[model samples]
Target: MPDAASTRAAPTASTASSTTLAIGFEGSANKISVGVARADGTILANPRETYVTPPGTGFLPRETAKHHRDVVVELARRALEEAKASMRDVDAVCFTRGPGMGAPLTTAAACARTLALLFDKPLVGVNHCVAHIEMGRLVTGARDPVVLYASGGNTQVIAYNERRYRIFGETIDIAVGNMLDRFARVCGLSNDPAPGYNIEQEAKKGTKFIEGPYGVKGMDVNLSGILTFYETYAKEHLGAGEVTVADLCMSMQETVFSMLVEITERAMAHTNAKDVLIVGGVGCNLRLQEMMAIMASERGGKLYGLDEDGRMDDRFCIDNGAMIAYTGLLQYENGETTPLEKTWCTQRFRTDEVLVTWRSEAVKRPASCEPPTV
Candidate 1:
C-alpha cells in the first residue's frame, strides 16, 4: 500500500480539485489490479498483474495471495502515476469484496482498507460479479440488456429486476472456464497467457469435433459431466491417434458455449429483453461473442461488447481494477459506502444479494410472459 503520509503531501481543501475520482483494488483471483477512474465513467488507468502457474497446473490460493501482496502496492502506484493523481485527489477507495479465493480477496481488502483509513476516504466494497456487469454496461452503454456473466469461477445468465441482478440461469456444477482449464491440463496446454485463450486458438484449427456430453437441465447447465468424459477419454484418444488436442478443444468449446447460448436466449425470451451483454473473463472469447450475436440478431436484438469484427477489448472484459472502481463509484454516487467495520471480504458473495440502490426502477416483465390475473 502507498503510504498516504510519506509519499505525497495531503492536499488541503483549498487545493483539492472539483473532479471526483476513486481508486480500486482487485485481487479476487490470480490477478491483482489497481485502477483510477473519474466520476464521469472515464477510466484514467488500470494496471494489473496475473499469477500464472506452469502447464498442467492451477494457481493455488496461498501462492496467488503472496503474488498479490507483492505486486498490489506497486500496481497501485503505477495506476496512480498513469492517472496523474494522488491519494488526496481521490474521493473514495474501492475493493472487490467477494466471490473469490479467500486469501487473495483478503489481500486486496487489506490494501483497500489501509488506503481508505490513511486517506480518510470512504470505502466501497464491490461485489466481483456486479462489478463485471456494471463495467460491461459502462463500456457498451447497455441499459437493460440480459447479461451473460461467465468466468473461471462463475457462469450465469442475469438481468436486472427489483433492484437486483437476478440470476435467470447458472451452472450447477463447475464453471465453464474451470472446465476449460482442467481440460487444458489433461491436454498439457500451457498456462502462460491463459488456458482458455490457448484452447480458443487451438479450436480454430480443428477440422474434426469429437462428441462430448451436454448437460442442460431447464435453466441450469452442468459442465462436470463433460469435463469428466474428456478427462477419461482424452489420453486414450491421443494415444490411439483418434483425436488431436485441437479437435478436443473444439468439442469442449462447442458443447459448453452452446449450453450458455441456449440459457441466455431462454432468459431473454422470458424477460423480453432485446439487448445481450457479455461480461467476465471468458466473455473475451470471440467465438462466444459470435454465437451470442447470432442469437441476438435472430430475435431482432443487438449484442453489446463486440465491435464490427466480433472482437472484444480485453480491458473491460477481463477482471480488472477499473471495473471495481467504476462500480464502487456508482455505489458511492448512490450514497452507499462501506464503513470500516463492515468492509470485510468474503469468499462467496452472490449476485442477487446486492440491493442495487443506483438502479431503483424495476424492469417490467412483458405482459405476455406475466402471470394471469387471479
Candidate 2:
C-alpha cells in the first residue's frame, strides 16, 4: 500500500520473460569491474580490479584509465570463468557510458565495443547512476523504492516517476563518498583497502560528536563547506589535541548521513513511496543505514539497504560491472541498445536524462517484507 502521505502507485514489473543473460563492463573510476547475470536475478559472476594510489593522494583519471585498459580483458575473462558460462550464453554486452571520469568510461566503452563486435552481441550503454539504483532494487528486492544514491562522485535523492527516475535532490559540490575519502586522505589514511570503512570503524570509539556545519539547502545537501571546515580543524586542532580524530569522523558521518536521510524522507513524502533504498558506495555505511532507518520509521516507512548479505561494503557498494550488467539487461528488455558508433562515454550524465520504458504501474512492495516498527 502507498503511504497516506502519497497517492502514487508503486511500479509493477512485467511478467513477460526474455533471455536476461548480460555481461557488463564498468570502469567509471578507480575500479574496473565485470559482471554476468540472468533475468531470473541470478548473478553468475562478478569480478573487480582496483587501482590503488599512494597514501595522501587521490585517484587520477589518467592513472585509473591506464589501470583499466591493462586489466579489463583479463578481468572479464575471469568473470566468465567464475560464472561457468561462455560468450555463447551472453545475450548482450553492456558498459557504463557516462557520469563518471571520462578516461575510465572511455576505456570501458572501447572495450565493450570490441567485445560486442567479437561476440556479435547487442551493445548497451548504461548510465552510471541508474546502474546503482537498479542494482539496489535487484539485490535488496525493494519495489517502488525512493532511492538515495551516495557515492564518491554523486549524492542524489531519486524517485521513479513517469518514464524516469527523477532526482528530487542532489549535491551542489563534492559527493558524500568523495568528501569521506578526501577527508580520510587528509587524516593521513591509506587508500589501499578502503577509506570510508576505516573511518566508520574508528568512529565507533568516538565519545563526543564534534559540532560541524550541517549543510542542507531545500532538498539538497552541501558537504563542501562542512568539509572545508573539518579540513581546517584537522590541520590546526587534530595535532594540537583540541579535537580527536574520532570526534571528527563520528560527527561527520552523523551530520552528512542525517542530511541525506532528511532529503530522502522528503522524497518519500513527495512520492508517497514507503520503501527507501540507499545505493552507491556510501550506502554501505551502517551509520548511514541506521540514521535512515530511524527517519523512515518515524514516517512509518521502511529503509532498505543493499548490503546483499554483507558484501555491499566491499563488492556491491562501490562501482562494479554487475550493476551495469543488471541494468543493461533491464534496458535491453525494453528494446534499448546502442550502436557501436554511438557508444561514447560521458563525464556528466544526470539521473533524469534517461527514459525508463522498463517498468509499469503494477503497484508492488518488497516481497516478504513487513513495515518498519515504530
Candidate 3:
C-alpha cells in the first residue's frame, strides 16, 4: 500500500480543469466494465462486457484470464466512443486493484498500465468494494450511513469511522450473491449473461416461501448452510417434479434477504447512523429494498435504495466504469494513489482495511432531467 505522502496530489481547485476526464476499468467477477467520467462526477460513457463460465464447471483461472485479455480492448474502445472521446483525451487511468480473482485483476492492471503508458497519464488502483459504496453515496447523497454490501465475493455491513471504514459485520463463508448464483445453477437457470437477474425474475413469480437457516453471529452472517439445505431438499423432493422453481426462488430470496435486513437493521441501531445505504449486485432486489425501506422508516431515518433509478442509477451498479472512476478520482484527490511498483491484488480484501477519506460534498441531481414520475 502507498502511504498518503507518496501519492500525487490532485490539482488544486483553482488549477483544476473543468473537463478533466478519468477512465476507469473494472474486471472483477466475469464482467469487464469501463467508464469515463468528468472531475465533478458526471458519467460520460459507460460500457461493459460480461464473460460466461460454463455451468457446472468450476471457475478456471487461466480461462478467465484469457477472456479478460481478449475482450477488454474492445470494451474500452466502445466506452471511449460512447463518451465521444478517445484514450488521448483521458487525464487518468483507474483499474480495480484487488478483492477479485487474481487472473482478472492482473489482466485489468496490465491493460490499465498499458493505457497509462500509451497516453502518458497517471494510473490509479481502486478497490471494487469501496467503489460500490462511493457509487451509493454519489447517487443517494446519504453521508456517513451504514452500508449493506451483498455480492458474489462479499457480504458486509460497513460504517465510516475514525479515519477508515470499519466492517461492523461480514460473511464468514460464501457471499449472498454467490449463494444465489449457485442456487440458480442448481435450478437450471440460464448461464447466459446475468444469472442473478434471471433468478430475480424467477423469484418474482414465486408465491410460496420456504424457510432456511439464518446464521447471525453478532453482525457477521453465513448463507452456505441455507444454500446446502435448499439444494438437498430440491434434489430429494423436486427431482420428482414436486416443487416449482419459482417457489424455490421465492423462498431463497425471502430467507436470505430477511437475514440481510436483520443485520442491516441491527447495524443501524448499533451505530446510531441516521441513514442506510445498500450496494452490490444483490442490492437490486425489490424485496431487499422494501425491507430496508420499512426498517429505515421504523427507525425514523432515511433509506437510500440504489435501484435502477437512484441518483447513481443502474449504470453505476452491476460493475461499471463510472463508479470505479469516481472512486479512483476520490483516491487520487485524497492523495492515496499507489505507485506501479507496489500495486497488487487481493482476492479477499476486507472493507475495514482501507480508511474512508472520501466525503459526500453535494447532492446529486435527479437521475434524469425529466419531471418526476407519478
Per lDDT, the best of the predicted structures is 1
TM-score of every candidate:
0.93, 0.90, 0.87
- Clashing pairs in model 1, backbone N/Cα/C closer than 3 A: none
Where is model 3 more than 4 Å wrong at Cα? 1-17, 54-59, 306-312, 360-374
lDDT of 3 by residue, 46-88 (tens): 7777777666433556787788789889878877877888888
**What's the distance in Å from true for residue 106, model 3?**
0.8
Residues 201-281, candidate 2: write the lDDT tens digits.
Answer: 878878878789989999898899999988888899888887888888888888888888888887787667777888888
Error of 3 at 233 (Å): 0.3
lDDT of each: 0.86, 0.80, 0.75
Q: For candidate 1, what is the lDDT?
A: 0.86
State residue 52's C-alpha deviation in candidate 1, in Å.
0.9
Report how far off residue 370 is in candidate 2 (Å).
28
Query: lDDT of candidate 2 vs native?
Result: 0.80
Q: Output the better candidate (1/3) by lDDT.
A: 1
